[model samples]
Target: MTHDHDHDHHDNDLDPMAARVRALETILTRKGLVDAAAIDAIVETYETKVGPRNGAHVVVKAWSDPAFADWLRRDATAAIASLGYAGRQGEHMQAVFNTAETHNLVVCTLCSCYPWSVLGLPPVWYKAPPYRSRAVLDPRGVLAEFGLVLPEGQKVRVWDSTAELRYLVIPMQPEGTEGWSEDRLAKLVSRDSMIGTAVALAPEAA
Candidate 1:
Protein backbone atom coordinates (compact mmCIF):
# COMPACT_ATOMS: atom_id res chain seq x y z
CA MET A 1 0.00 0.00 0.00
CA THR A 2 3.04 2.31 -0.04
CA HIS A 3 2.88 5.03 -2.74
CA ASP A 4 6.17 6.78 -2.29
CA HIS A 5 7.04 7.00 -5.99
CA ASP A 6 5.85 10.05 -7.95
CA HIS A 7 4.66 7.89 -10.85
CA ASP A 8 1.42 9.70 -11.74
CA HIS A 9 -0.81 6.71 -12.39
CA HIS A 10 -3.89 5.76 -10.44
CA ASP A 11 -4.69 2.08 -9.87
CA ASN A 12 -7.89 2.44 -11.92
CA ASP A 13 -6.01 3.94 -14.87
CA LEU A 14 -5.12 0.53 -16.22
CA ASP A 15 -7.30 -2.47 -17.05
CA PRO A 16 -4.77 -5.17 -17.85
CA MET A 17 -7.25 -7.54 -19.43
CA ALA A 18 -8.63 -4.96 -21.85
CA ALA A 19 -5.14 -3.92 -22.78
CA ARG A 20 -4.23 -7.55 -23.44
CA VAL A 21 -7.28 -7.95 -25.67
CA ARG A 22 -6.24 -4.93 -27.69
CA ALA A 23 -2.78 -6.36 -28.09
CA LEU A 24 -4.20 -9.68 -29.21
CA GLU A 25 -6.43 -7.92 -31.74
CA THR A 26 -3.39 -6.18 -33.26
CA ILE A 27 -1.57 -9.51 -33.44
CA LEU A 28 -4.56 -11.22 -35.03
CA THR A 29 -4.94 -8.47 -37.66
CA ARG A 30 -1.24 -8.66 -38.48
CA LYS A 31 -1.62 -12.42 -38.95
CA GLY A 32 -4.71 -11.84 -41.19
CA LEU A 33 -6.97 -14.31 -39.38
CA VAL A 34 -9.56 -12.04 -37.70
CA ASP A 35 -13.07 -11.97 -39.16
CA ALA A 36 -14.83 -8.78 -38.11
CA ALA A 37 -18.14 -9.75 -39.71
CA ALA A 38 -18.41 -13.00 -37.77
CA ILE A 39 -17.70 -11.21 -34.50
CA ASP A 40 -20.32 -8.57 -35.33
CA ALA A 41 -22.92 -11.21 -36.10
CA ILE A 42 -22.29 -13.01 -32.81
CA VAL A 43 -22.49 -9.79 -30.81
CA GLU A 44 -25.67 -8.70 -32.59
CA THR A 45 -27.33 -12.04 -32.00
CA TYR A 46 -26.72 -11.96 -28.26
CA GLU A 47 -27.59 -8.30 -27.88
CA THR A 48 -30.85 -8.62 -29.74
CA LYS A 49 -32.29 -12.12 -29.68
CA VAL A 50 -30.51 -14.12 -26.98
CA GLY A 51 -30.36 -11.80 -23.97
CA PRO A 52 -32.61 -11.05 -20.97
CA ARG A 53 -35.13 -8.74 -22.64
CA ASN A 54 -36.81 -11.89 -23.94
CA GLY A 55 -37.08 -13.19 -20.40
CA ALA A 56 -38.47 -9.90 -19.15
CA HIS A 57 -41.33 -10.18 -21.61
CA VAL A 58 -42.20 -13.63 -20.31
CA VAL A 59 -42.07 -12.51 -16.69
CA VAL A 60 -44.31 -9.59 -17.54
CA LYS A 61 -46.86 -11.84 -19.19
CA ALA A 62 -46.79 -14.15 -16.20
CA TRP A 63 -47.40 -11.22 -13.89
CA SER A 64 -50.37 -10.03 -15.87
CA ASP A 65 -51.85 -13.56 -16.12
CA PRO A 66 -52.04 -16.03 -13.28
CA ALA A 67 -52.00 -19.10 -15.51
CA PHE A 68 -48.80 -18.01 -17.22
CA ALA A 69 -47.12 -17.53 -13.86
CA ASP A 70 -48.02 -21.09 -12.89
CA TRP A 71 -46.63 -22.35 -16.16
CA LEU A 72 -43.43 -20.32 -15.85
CA ARG A 73 -42.79 -21.54 -12.34
CA ARG A 74 -43.46 -25.10 -13.48
CA ASP A 75 -41.53 -25.06 -16.77
CA ALA A 76 -39.87 -21.74 -17.60
CA THR A 77 -38.56 -22.68 -21.06
CA ALA A 78 -41.87 -23.79 -22.50
CA ALA A 79 -43.79 -21.12 -20.64
CA ILE A 80 -41.54 -18.50 -22.20
CA ALA A 81 -42.06 -19.98 -25.66
CA SER A 82 -45.78 -19.55 -25.20
CA LEU A 83 -44.95 -15.96 -26.27
CA GLY A 84 -42.37 -16.80 -29.07
CA TYR A 85 -39.01 -15.70 -27.52
CA ALA A 86 -37.64 -19.18 -27.18
CA GLY A 87 -34.24 -20.52 -28.29
CA ARG A 88 -30.57 -21.06 -27.23
CA GLN A 89 -29.61 -20.29 -23.61
CA GLY A 90 -33.24 -19.93 -22.64
CA GLU A 91 -33.98 -23.51 -23.62
CA HIS A 92 -33.69 -24.48 -19.93
CA MET A 93 -34.53 -22.18 -17.06
CA GLN A 94 -35.92 -22.54 -13.54
CA ALA A 95 -37.92 -19.80 -11.90
CA VAL A 96 -37.21 -19.55 -8.20
CA PHE A 97 -39.49 -17.75 -5.78
CA ASN A 98 -38.65 -15.13 -3.19
CA THR A 99 -41.53 -15.18 -0.75
CA ALA A 100 -42.17 -14.06 2.82
CA GLU A 101 -41.00 -17.37 4.31
CA THR A 102 -38.09 -18.23 2.00
CA HIS A 103 -35.62 -16.09 0.06
CA ASN A 104 -34.03 -17.66 -2.98
CA LEU A 105 -30.47 -16.65 -3.89
CA VAL A 106 -28.62 -17.45 -7.14
CA VAL A 107 -24.91 -17.60 -7.80
CA CYS A 108 -22.56 -19.24 -10.27
CA THR A 109 -19.69 -20.61 -8.23
CA LEU A 110 -17.42 -21.30 -11.22
CA CYS A 111 -18.66 -18.58 -13.58
CA SER A 112 -21.56 -16.22 -14.15
CA CYS A 113 -24.39 -18.52 -15.29
CA TYR A 114 -27.29 -16.13 -15.50
CA PRO A 115 -30.68 -16.23 -17.16
CA TRP A 116 -29.62 -13.95 -20.00
CA SER A 117 -32.95 -14.28 -21.80
CA VAL A 118 -34.63 -12.17 -19.10
CA LEU A 119 -31.69 -10.38 -17.53
CA GLY A 120 -29.23 -8.54 -19.79
CA LEU A 121 -25.63 -8.79 -18.65
CA PRO A 122 -24.75 -9.85 -15.12
CA PRO A 123 -23.62 -6.96 -12.99
CA VAL A 124 -19.95 -6.85 -12.03
CA TRP A 125 -20.77 -7.55 -8.41
CA TYR A 126 -22.84 -10.60 -9.34
CA LYS A 127 -19.71 -12.16 -10.87
CA ALA A 128 -17.54 -11.23 -7.91
CA PRO A 129 -16.22 -14.06 -5.79
CA PRO A 130 -17.32 -12.43 -2.56
CA TYR A 131 -20.95 -12.60 -3.63
CA ARG A 132 -20.65 -16.14 -4.97
CA SER A 133 -19.05 -17.45 -1.78
CA ARG A 134 -21.09 -15.54 0.84
CA ALA A 135 -24.53 -15.64 -0.79
CA VAL A 136 -25.03 -19.36 -0.17
CA LEU A 137 -23.61 -19.71 3.33
CA ASP A 138 -25.20 -16.57 4.82
CA PRO A 139 -28.11 -15.59 2.62
CA ARG A 140 -29.84 -13.38 5.15
CA GLY A 141 -26.69 -11.44 5.90
CA VAL A 142 -25.91 -10.95 2.21
CA LEU A 143 -29.41 -9.69 1.52
CA ALA A 144 -29.16 -7.37 4.51
CA GLU A 145 -26.03 -5.85 3.02
CA PHE A 146 -28.01 -5.19 -0.16
CA GLY A 147 -30.64 -3.38 1.99
CA LEU A 148 -33.12 -6.27 1.85
CA VAL A 149 -33.45 -7.55 5.41
CA LEU A 150 -36.11 -10.20 5.83
CA PRO A 151 -38.46 -10.72 8.76
CA GLU A 152 -37.66 -12.99 11.67
CA GLY A 153 -37.75 -16.78 11.07
CA GLN A 154 -37.54 -16.47 7.29
CA LYS A 155 -35.50 -19.14 5.54
CA VAL A 156 -33.10 -18.69 2.60
CA ARG A 157 -31.97 -21.11 -0.09
CA VAL A 158 -29.07 -20.39 -2.45
CA TRP A 159 -28.94 -22.20 -5.79
CA ASP A 160 -25.53 -22.86 -7.28
CA SER A 161 -25.83 -22.67 -11.05
CA THR A 162 -24.56 -25.33 -13.45
CA ALA A 163 -24.63 -25.95 -17.21
CA GLU A 164 -27.91 -27.86 -17.31
CA LEU A 165 -30.38 -25.19 -16.22
CA ARG A 166 -30.38 -21.41 -15.87
CA TYR A 167 -32.06 -19.58 -12.97
CA LEU A 168 -34.25 -16.49 -12.78
CA VAL A 169 -35.91 -14.89 -9.76
CA ILE A 170 -39.68 -14.55 -10.03
CA PRO A 171 -40.17 -11.43 -7.96
CA MET A 172 -43.51 -10.60 -6.45
CA GLN A 173 -45.54 -8.11 -8.42
CA PRO A 174 -45.40 -4.65 -6.95
CA GLU A 175 -48.45 -3.04 -5.39
CA GLY A 176 -50.91 -1.03 -7.51
CA THR A 177 -50.63 -2.89 -10.81
CA GLU A 178 -54.23 -3.97 -11.26
CA GLY A 179 -55.70 -4.23 -14.76
CA TRP A 180 -52.54 -3.53 -16.67
CA SER A 181 -51.78 -4.92 -20.12
CA GLU A 182 -48.97 -7.41 -20.71
CA ASP A 183 -46.90 -4.86 -22.64
CA ARG A 184 -47.24 -2.25 -19.92
CA LEU A 185 -46.43 -4.78 -17.21
CA ALA A 186 -43.36 -6.00 -19.09
CA LYS A 187 -41.89 -2.53 -18.90
CA LEU A 188 -41.70 -2.84 -15.12
CA VAL A 189 -39.73 -6.06 -15.09
CA SER A 190 -36.19 -4.77 -14.64
CA ARG A 191 -33.03 -6.86 -14.56
CA ASP A 192 -32.93 -6.57 -10.79
CA SER A 193 -36.28 -8.32 -10.51
CA MET A 194 -34.86 -11.34 -12.27
CA ILE A 195 -31.79 -11.18 -9.99
CA GLY A 196 -34.05 -10.96 -6.87
CA THR A 197 -32.19 -7.99 -5.38
CA ALA A 198 -34.98 -5.49 -6.12
CA VAL A 199 -38.71 -5.75 -6.63
CA ALA A 200 -40.38 -5.17 -9.97
CA LEU A 201 -41.05 -1.58 -10.89
CA ALA A 202 -44.63 -0.41 -10.47
CA PRO A 203 -46.52 0.32 -13.67
CA GLU A 204 -47.04 3.88 -12.50
CA ALA A 205 -43.28 4.35 -12.33
CA ALA A 206 -43.03 3.82 -16.07
Candidate 2:
Protein backbone atom coordinates (compact mmCIF):
# COMPACT_ATOMS: atom_id res chain seq x y z
CA MET A 1 0.00 0.00 0.00
CA THR A 2 1.30 3.37 -1.00
CA HIS A 3 1.21 6.05 1.68
CA ASP A 4 -0.07 9.46 0.66
CA HIS A 5 2.69 11.62 2.09
CA ASP A 6 1.91 14.42 -0.34
CA HIS A 7 0.17 16.37 2.42
CA ASP A 8 3.62 17.18 3.70
CA HIS A 9 4.98 19.57 1.11
CA HIS A 10 8.40 19.19 2.68
CA ASP A 11 8.78 15.66 1.35
CA ASN A 12 12.45 16.31 0.65
CA ASP A 13 13.08 17.33 4.29
CA LEU A 14 12.07 14.86 6.97
CA ASP A 15 11.08 16.31 10.33
CA PRO A 16 12.69 14.93 13.47
CA MET A 17 9.62 12.89 14.38
CA ALA A 18 9.31 11.46 10.86
CA ALA A 19 13.01 10.62 10.77
CA ARG A 20 12.68 8.87 14.12
CA VAL A 21 9.69 6.89 12.90
CA ARG A 22 11.59 5.81 9.80
CA ALA A 23 14.60 4.82 11.88
CA LEU A 24 12.41 2.80 14.23
CA GLU A 25 10.73 1.05 11.31
CA THR A 26 14.12 0.19 9.85
CA ILE A 27 15.44 -1.15 13.16
CA LEU A 28 12.33 -3.25 13.77
CA THR A 29 12.43 -4.62 10.25
CA ARG A 30 16.10 -5.49 10.52
CA LYS A 31 15.65 -7.12 13.95
CA GLY A 32 12.71 -9.21 12.64
CA LEU A 33 10.50 -7.57 15.26
CA VAL A 34 8.15 -6.31 12.56
CA ASP A 35 7.09 -7.66 9.18
CA ALA A 36 7.54 -5.02 6.50
CA ALA A 37 4.89 -6.68 4.36
CA ALA A 38 2.35 -6.54 7.21
CA ILE A 39 3.14 -2.88 7.76
CA ASP A 40 2.61 -2.19 4.09
CA ALA A 41 -0.71 -4.04 4.11
CA ILE A 42 -2.01 -2.03 7.05
CA VAL A 43 -0.92 1.26 5.52
CA GLU A 44 -2.49 0.24 2.24
CA THR A 45 -5.75 -0.64 3.93
CA TYR A 46 -5.99 2.75 5.58
CA GLU A 47 -4.78 4.64 2.50
CA THR A 48 -6.92 2.98 -0.14
CA LYS A 49 -9.70 1.05 1.60
CA VAL A 50 -10.60 3.37 4.46
CA GLY A 51 -9.30 6.87 3.95
CA PRO A 52 -10.81 10.11 2.64
CA ARG A 53 -13.02 8.13 0.28
CA ASN A 54 -15.13 7.06 3.24
CA GLY A 55 -15.48 10.66 4.36
CA ALA A 56 -16.33 11.68 0.83
CA HIS A 57 -19.10 9.11 0.69
CA VAL A 58 -20.49 10.45 3.95
CA VAL A 59 -20.39 13.99 2.61
CA VAL A 60 -22.05 12.95 -0.62
CA LYS A 61 -24.82 11.16 1.22
CA ALA A 62 -25.40 14.20 3.38
CA TRP A 63 -25.48 16.42 0.32
CA SER A 64 -27.95 14.17 -1.50
CA ASP A 65 -30.17 13.31 1.45
CA PRO A 66 -31.53 16.06 3.67
CA ALA A 67 -32.75 13.58 6.28
CA PHE A 68 -29.30 12.06 6.55
CA ALA A 69 -27.80 15.50 6.96
CA ASP A 70 -30.22 16.22 9.81
CA TRP A 71 -29.40 12.86 11.39
CA LEU A 72 -25.68 13.53 10.97
CA ARG A 73 -26.06 16.85 12.77
CA ARG A 74 -28.07 15.25 15.57
CA ASP A 75 -25.83 12.19 16.07
CA ALA A 76 -22.70 12.09 13.97
CA THR A 77 -21.31 8.97 15.60
CA ALA A 78 -24.35 6.84 14.95
CA ALA A 79 -24.91 8.37 11.55
CA ILE A 80 -21.35 7.71 10.44
CA ALA A 81 -21.33 4.27 12.00
CA SER A 82 -24.46 3.48 10.03
CA LEU A 83 -22.29 3.77 6.96
CA GLY A 84 -19.70 1.37 8.45
CA TYR A 85 -17.06 4.06 9.07
CA ALA A 86 -16.64 3.81 12.82
CA GLY A 87 -13.47 2.75 14.63
CA ARG A 88 -10.56 3.87 16.84
CA GLN A 89 -10.23 7.65 17.16
CA GLY A 90 -13.60 7.91 15.41
CA GLU A 91 -15.80 6.19 17.97
CA HIS A 92 -17.39 9.49 18.94
CA MET A 93 -17.87 11.82 16.00
CA GLN A 94 -19.26 15.31 15.58
CA ALA A 95 -20.16 16.69 12.19
CA VAL A 96 -19.91 20.45 11.77
CA PHE A 97 -21.50 22.08 8.77
CA ASN A 98 -20.06 25.02 6.91
CA THR A 99 -22.56 27.53 5.62
CA ALA A 100 -22.52 30.91 3.99
CA GLU A 101 -22.70 32.57 7.38
CA THR A 102 -20.46 30.24 9.36
CA HIS A 103 -17.22 28.38 8.61
CA ASN A 104 -16.17 25.55 10.88
CA LEU A 105 -12.53 24.77 11.70
CA VAL A 106 -11.26 21.81 13.78
CA VAL A 107 -8.08 21.52 15.79
CA CYS A 108 -6.63 19.32 18.51
CA THR A 109 -5.13 21.80 20.95
CA LEU A 110 -3.44 19.18 23.11
CA CYS A 111 -2.45 16.62 20.50
CA SER A 112 -3.61 15.08 17.24
CA CYS A 113 -6.96 13.50 18.00
CA TYR A 114 -7.97 12.94 14.43
CA PRO A 115 -10.61 10.63 12.91
CA TRP A 116 -8.27 8.14 11.31
CA SER A 117 -11.05 5.76 10.26
CA VAL A 118 -12.41 8.19 7.73
CA LEU A 119 -9.58 10.61 7.07
CA GLY A 120 -6.68 8.17 7.42
CA LEU A 121 -3.63 9.46 9.30
CA PRO A 122 -3.53 13.07 10.43
CA PRO A 123 -1.48 15.27 8.14
CA VAL A 124 1.85 16.40 9.59
CA TRP A 125 0.79 20.03 9.66
CA TYR A 126 -2.39 19.16 11.55
CA LYS A 127 -0.24 17.81 14.37
CA ALA A 128 2.26 20.66 14.21
CA PRO A 129 2.40 23.26 17.00
CA PRO A 130 1.85 26.19 14.66
CA TYR A 131 -1.45 24.84 13.33
CA ARG A 132 -2.66 23.66 16.74
CA SER A 133 -1.95 27.01 18.38
CA ARG A 134 -3.05 29.33 15.59
CA ALA A 135 -6.11 27.33 14.60
CA VAL A 136 -7.76 28.55 17.78
CA LEU A 137 -6.03 31.90 18.18
CA ASP A 138 -6.17 33.07 14.56
CA PRO A 139 -8.47 30.84 12.54
CA ARG A 140 -8.88 33.32 9.71
CA GLY A 141 -5.15 33.82 9.40
CA VAL A 142 -4.58 30.08 9.43
CA LEU A 143 -7.28 29.54 6.84
CA ALA A 144 -5.68 32.22 4.71
CA GLU A 145 -2.39 30.33 4.86
CA PHE A 146 -4.24 27.30 3.48
CA GLY A 147 -5.46 29.54 0.64
CA LEU A 148 -9.02 29.56 1.95
CA VAL A 149 -10.12 33.13 2.37
CA LEU A 150 -13.53 33.43 3.94
CA PRO A 151 -15.69 36.49 3.60
CA GLU A 152 -15.18 39.18 6.25
CA GLY A 153 -18.81 38.82 7.34
CA GLN A 154 -18.61 35.08 7.80
CA LYS A 155 -18.20 33.76 11.33
CA VAL A 156 -15.41 31.25 11.99
CA ARG A 157 -16.20 28.51 14.48
CA VAL A 158 -13.23 26.53 15.78
CA TRP A 159 -13.87 23.10 17.27
CA ASP A 160 -11.31 21.54 19.54
CA SER A 161 -11.06 17.78 19.10
CA THR A 162 -10.44 15.53 22.06
CA ALA A 163 -9.64 11.87 22.71
CA GLU A 164 -13.33 11.31 23.43
CA LEU A 165 -14.74 13.10 20.42
CA ARG A 166 -13.53 13.90 16.92
CA TYR A 167 -14.89 16.61 14.66
CA LEU A 168 -15.55 16.45 10.90
CA VAL A 169 -16.30 19.56 8.91
CA ILE A 170 -18.99 19.15 6.25
CA PRO A 171 -18.14 21.75 3.65
CA MET A 172 -20.86 23.41 1.66
CA GLN A 173 -21.62 21.83 -1.71
CA PRO A 174 -20.10 23.75 -4.53
CA GLU A 175 -22.26 25.56 -7.06
CA GLY A 176 -22.90 24.44 -10.65
CA THR A 177 -23.04 20.86 -9.46
CA GLU A 178 -26.78 20.42 -9.70
CA GLY A 179 -27.94 17.03 -11.06
CA TRP A 180 -24.53 15.55 -10.39
CA SER A 181 -24.32 11.94 -9.22
CA GLU A 182 -23.18 11.07 -5.72
CA ASP A 183 -19.98 9.54 -7.10
CA ARG A 184 -19.24 12.74 -8.96
CA LEU A 185 -20.00 14.82 -5.90
CA ALA A 186 -17.80 12.59 -3.79
CA LYS A 187 -14.89 13.38 -6.06
CA LEU A 188 -15.09 17.01 -5.02
CA VAL A 189 -14.99 16.22 -1.29
CA SER A 190 -11.32 16.45 -0.36
CA ARG A 191 -9.63 15.34 2.85
CA ASP A 192 -8.67 18.94 3.64
CA SER A 193 -12.29 19.98 3.24
CA MET A 194 -13.37 17.48 5.90
CA ILE A 195 -10.62 18.89 8.14
CA GLY A 196 -11.82 22.46 7.39
CA THR A 197 -8.43 23.47 6.05
CA ALA A 198 -9.96 23.83 2.59
CA VAL A 199 -13.38 23.89 0.96
CA ALA A 200 -14.81 21.26 -1.40
CA LEU A 201 -13.34 21.38 -4.87
CA ALA A 202 -15.32 23.29 -7.45
CA PRO A 203 -16.60 21.27 -10.43
CA GLU A 204 -14.38 23.23 -12.78
CA ALA A 205 -11.45 22.92 -10.43
CA ALA A 206 -11.65 19.16 -10.62
TM-score of every candidate: 0.75, 0.79
Give the alpha carbon lDDT tens digit for every residue of 1-206 in model 1: 57676688654544789888878877887798886776678789777766656767777777777898898888877886677755454348888876778766788888888776567668999999999888877877778888776678867777887767778887767778877787777788777667766667756677
Q: In model 1, which runs have C-alpha deviations exceeding 4 angstroms?
A: 1-35, 47-52, 87-91, 202-206
The window of 10 residues in a row where model 1 has the poorest summed lDDT is: 82-91
lDDT of each: 0.75, 0.92
Best by the TM-score measure: 2
Which residue pairs does candidate 2 place in steric collision? none
The alpha-carbon lDDT assigned to residue 48 of candidate 2 equals 75
Q: What is the lDDT for 192 in model 2?
A: 96
